[model samples]
Target: MLIEAAGLCAGYGDARVLHGVDLSVGEGEIVALLGRNGMGKTTTVKALMGLLPAMAGRIHMGGTDVTALPAHRRARLGLGLVPEGRRVFPTLTVEENLRATAVPGGRWSLPDVYALFPRLAERRSNFGNQLSGGEQQMLAIGRALLTDPRVLILDEATEGLAPVIRREIWATLARLKDEGQAILLADSRLQAILALADRAVILTKGEIAWTGATAALQADAELQRRHLAV
Candidate 1:
């Protein structure tokens, strides 16, 4: 498995958010972490990335125990995160942003990222703040890829974007999957995720409520209504 997170427990100072949540992503597999608002999806991502301390858990990446590693160490160990918001550097231009965190001799190069996202190449000279929401998203993904991570974790992969742009991002994700990228994605769009993910894990109130193949979840509407309906 590219990522193995088990017995994960984390929370803000006084409010506990995750309750021993467990998730895994294998090589070349796309896993969806689905849930309604306040269901601990983002918290899970934070814990995995070491952005927030894991109150209790074990996180293994490429068979290495990373529970104690800092965020940067985790990144060096092949974990890349395109966080909830497309948090690109507002002062840096598109090209600079892509260069800032790039690893030496990485599998992904500037040309490769630009090829995946032509819009980025067109706006390479534009500052991060100058880009539209969709453009920022593209830049974020491109920047992460430049790290040549073993597993990519996308929190709210396509949120607050035009439908056309959302589709474009989904298509990009599909292509990445086709290329043997392991991904853990969190999003509200049911059909889109179901179409892309091999397996789905549903969270309710910070605990895993259901987990199975995507096809099984798609066939059971009641499960969706019970845990995912707004």
Candidate 2:
């Protein structure tokens, strides 16, 4: 497994979120974390990235226990996250934003990112805040990829975007998956994720409701209704 979480727990001050959540993303696999809103999807990613503290359980990136490691330390272990929102550096230009968090001596480089998203290359001088919604998203994904992460995560990757942009983003994701980059994706678009993902894991409330191949997940409508519907 490229990334694994065993019996994980995390929460706000007193409102506990995840309850023994067990999830894993294998190398070169696109694993989608499916759930309705506020179902601890983003929280799980945050905990794994060390943005939030894990009160209990183990977080292993490539079989090393990184539960106690800080976010920067985890990044050094090849973990990259394109957060819930497209949290780009508003003051920095597109190129600068990619320059800031980019892990040097990594597999992917500046030219690679430019080649991946030509639109970003055109807007290289635009500050993050100046980019369009889709452009910002592209920058976010590009920034993460520049880290050359073994496991790259996206939380609500295409939320609140135009249909065209969303489609483009999904297509880009498909390309990334084809390139054998391990991806952990959380989004409201179940159908899209299911089609692209090799495996699907549904989170109900805070527990694992189902875990199976994408085909099985799609065939079982009852599973979706129970764990995913509003």
Candidate 3:
């Protein structure tokens, strides 16, 4: 597996939001982190990325135990995160944001990212705050890709976007999967996730409710209704 977290526990301050959550993303795999509002989907991803410290768990990246590593160290080990809020640097231009955390001599470069989202190329000079939500999302994905991460985790991958923009993002994710990139994403769009992800991990109240092949989850309407339905 490119990234693995077993018995993950994390949260903000004293309030724990994840309880023994386990997740893994192997090479060329696409895993969906599914759950309703206030679940630990964001916390789980944060713990894996070392943004939120794991109170009691082990995080391994490329077979190395990275439980003690910080966020930048984890990034060096090829764990990239596009955070839930599309937290791009508001003061910097689009190009600057892409270059901020970029790893040199990697498979991905500015040109490559621009090619993946040509809209970014056209708005390269715009500040992060100036772009529309979808544009900012594109920039966020591009910035993460420039890090050449072995495992990419996107929290709320398509949270509040127009249908057309969401489709574009989904297509981009599909292309990344086809090119053998490992991905873990959290999103509420069940049908889109079902079509793209190989596996699904459902979270409920900071605990893992279910983990299995996406096909199995899709076939079990009861399971979806129990954990995922609004």
Candidate 4:
């Protein structure tokens, strides 16, 4: 597995949002983490990225234990995250935002990112706050790509975008998958996930409710209703 977490437990203050979650993303694979709101999907992503400390669990990257590492260390070890809200630096130019956390001598570069999202290239000089929501999302994904992550984790991959932009993002993800990028995606869009992910892991109140191939998840309507219905 490129990224693996076993018995991951975390929370805010004393609130314990996640409980014994186990998930993994292998090389050249796409895994979708699905659940309704407040079900610890984001917490799981944060824990794996080292943004949130694991209360009791183990996280491994390329078979090396990384549970004790900090966020920067995890990034160095090849964990890249596109957070829920597309949190780009408001004060930085688009080019600067891409460079802020970038690791030199990686597979990604400024020109490559710009080519992937030409809109960003067009707005290269604009501050993060100056861009629209979809532009910010593209910038976020581009910034993460610049890290050359072994496992790219995206939380709420496309939450609040126009239909066209959402489709564009999904298409970009498909292209990434084609190029053998290992991705762990947490999103509410079921149909898109089913089409893109190889495997599916469903969560309910922090614990894993069900896990299997995406085909199985798509076929089980009752299971979806039980754990994923809004």
- Go through the candidates in order and give each one's C-alpha lDDT: 0.92, 0.89, 0.90, 0.92
When 1 and 3 are scored with TM-score, the better candidate is 1
lDDT of 1 by residue, 1-230 (tens): 88899999999997889999989999899999999988999999989998888888899987799999999999998989999998999999999999997998999999999999999999999999999999999999999998889999899988998999999999999999999999999866587898899999999888999999999999999998888853
Candidate 4 TM-score, true structure as reference: 0.97
**Candidate 3 or 4, higher lDDT?**
4
Clashes of 4: 0
Model 3 per-residue lDDT tens digits across residues 1-230: 88888988888899888989888999899999999888888788888888889988899987799999999999989988899989999999999999997888988989999999999999999999999999999999998998998998899988888899999999999999999999998876588898899999999998989999999999999998888853
Model 3 TM: 0.97
Q: What's the distance in Å from true for residue 13, model 2? A: 0.9
**Model 2: per-residue Cα lDDT over 1-230, one tens digit each:** 88899999998889889998899999799998988888889999999999999988999988689999999999889899999888999999999999997888888898899998999999999999999999999999999998889999999999888999999999999999999999999865587787799998888787888888989988887877777752
Which pairs of residues collide in model 4?
none
Against the hidden reference, what TM-scores do the models get? Answer: 0.98, 0.97, 0.97, 0.97
Candidate 2's TM-score: 0.97
- Lowest-sum lDDT 10-residue window in model 3: 185-194
For model 1 the local lDDT of residue 100 reads: 95
